[model samples]
Target: MRQLVTVSCVLLLAVSGFAQEDSSQPRPFVEIAEQDVKPSVQAIAPIDDTNVFFLNKRGQAGVAKFSPGLSLIGWELYSKVKLNSLNSLGMGPNYSLVTASPIEITQAFDTAGDGSLDFFQGLVRDWQGRDNGVRITAGPVADSNGRLLFALSPFSIEEGQPPLARLVAWHPDSEGLQTVTESQLLISSFSVGPDSLLAARLSMPAYTEGYYISLTGLPSFLADSPDAVPDPLPKTLPSLLIPAELTGGKEPTQMCFFGENNQTKLVLTCPESNQLIEIVPEKSGSQWQGAILLRSQTPSSIESVVEMNSGLLLGGGPDGFFPLEIPAEAFRIESVNIAKDGIVLNFSEEVDRFQGVKPDSYTVKAVSLRGDNKTLMVEPVIESDGKTVILKTSEIGKGVVLRVVCQNLPSADGDALFNKTVFYTIHES
Candidate 1:
């Protein structure tokens, strides 16, 4: 390792906390304190809520101090790997950092403890798939134990070979990687949900050009050798969305959970769209399913995300860093519950009770698998709580996706509803 260029962590926190606050003009974001790392930033990982480390397209790794403002205390060139880009970053065991590139997964260590991540090790390298031009997508996702999972895809599939992608697992103590699940639809952007069934975002060309948000009852592979690519996940994906509006454009490539200890959210970052989408994951029985809502558009692209202890959100993209705040209640749908009769709509804020009782304020439609659609005029009932509106009707079908749009439902707090549309996938009971 090159002689470490160090910055003391003690001074970083102190300086970072002194971020000058301005109250005259109120904004949701924390103080602006990021220094641009110009080479197309791909991912970010928090050493803690107060500090972060970032990787760029040029394969350069750097550290920044953030509380209020971001201060680039130090950075390092990392390795002689000549890698073009680093796609993913995650905090590994013992405060060490993990990163993924097209060719390898590496871990960085601040062994000397001078606040510089000085030591580098290729934890999983010479991966077999790289020969076919492997691209590591999501992960370095840590389980309750310290083991890691990576989603991988190889671009060049030879004729007669399985046209497949994979979810690979690597143990820190082991010398190699193992196949977690190999599939024609191996997800590179997501993983198992609360039900332990893998819930993933699948690129569905059949639906147009967008991703098919999926919940699967697929079986994981028994861990095998590095070269052992396993069976493909069943093609009859226990999925949602009968092709809907998820066509023509792409969904975000990266996803993260933010807003810790409060309202946690799964935020998906799309650098191209300059928008972060929050996907609602709902589990019915053994299947995990849900919808994707355009959360908020950013001033800059966001490729990675993390939430600070102070509840402020931070995002990093191709152009560098951005300070962000969670989507205001006005720009969110607090929750969507499907009822046997109709559907219950929940607002993030106290919505006007009068509008909740108006059938004219609601537009309901159901799309069945046979390309059949049914429109409904529901009998609306405002619940005891002003935050929820219950619409009752058996007009919606059991096997169709119900799309509910609550229009003219103004909030009592004078906040306009940012999104009135919700898609509820009704699976076979």
Candidate 2:
């Protein structure tokens, strides 16, 4: 009996050690089922915290559902669709898959009319209006009303010919797929605003510079006659374009609407100059007039901008995703004045210390009446408030054409200065 008791104690201690060792081990970053497949995921669309849909590079698509701890609950791969190129993916109501591809955009059906589903060819319209060929770049996005909207630009490979672009709306109908819209702008990006109005960024090869166009008082269509052609968009509807000066001479890339119903506002992203612009309808003007609200800096080039429950998700970076909160007001140069002792540079916000703030960072040129340019050496001093910088130089005097070139000046958060050159004629005072 004594031998048996000692053996039992030893066994109990060994089991306890094993349990402690297992408990101390760390868990995996994410848990997936053994049957879960792994694909080369290029883009991910979050249906919710626990559900996501992904599109792979080879045109394969799948939906993944996860539990609270990210354990895979279900995974379903859809039938592969042959596409020339796939750009974006969206989910419509009833788990319908919406994609923007080079192939003819269509609903799931026997497109071949052979009484069988075989992904073979797309419907292409040639100059003769027959199915032949054309290259198209399009992006499809689903709206709240279970409709798919596409920004399509069709171009030919032939040299020196640029095709027109337009915005198209697709709806399900008994006769067949119904399409509508009369926009002639080359839409880079767009979003549905309040009351289902359309807001789009229009730019093209002919004029690379972009601007905003908003459509108001658009009419609704309930099932138009199949035989009749869709009516051309009415011109009397109020359309507004944000001023070009406010855009800093750069093209607007993507945009989305913020807020709900009557409080909605449009936010545009400009990639060339790294700017986020906001525009709101003016209270007491024609419907076409809109006032600029803010223009701020963004850290990365944005390809897609989507508003979510938490905030905005900016995609098309090396990391594939970045969260954008409401940015703090940006720092900007307010005024430049010629003082008795030095040149006073006033800023809208506190300036940060960087290589740009050094006196050597500036190129001071004194232009003579004979078109001679001479460099001026100076020393920079930051004021106590951090909003003012004084440049002391002997080369600044009466009748001198003073040109200050400031470059690479960054804010505390690393936002570079936008405007580089400041010119002034120093008069006797």
Residue-pair clashes per candidate: 1, 0
- List the candidate 1 regions with Cα displacement exceeding 4 Å: 1-40, 68-83, 111-114, 128-135, 154-161, 191-199, 205-209, 216-250, 258-265, 307-312, 318-320, 327-331, 413-415
For model 2, what is the alpha-carbon lDDT of residue 235?
31
Best by TM-score: 1
lDDT of 1: 0.60
Lowest lDDT sum, 10 consecutive residues, model 1, at 1-10
List of clashing residue pairs for candidate 1: 33-70
Q: State residue 153's C-alpha deviation in candidate 2, in Å.
A: 4.7
lDDT of each: 0.60, 0.50
lDDT of 2 by residue, 154-264 (tens): 432244644435444444431222333434555655667666666665554464333546544334554453223345443322244444444667766667766623356
RMSD of each: 10.7, 20.3
Error of 2 at 362 (Å): 24
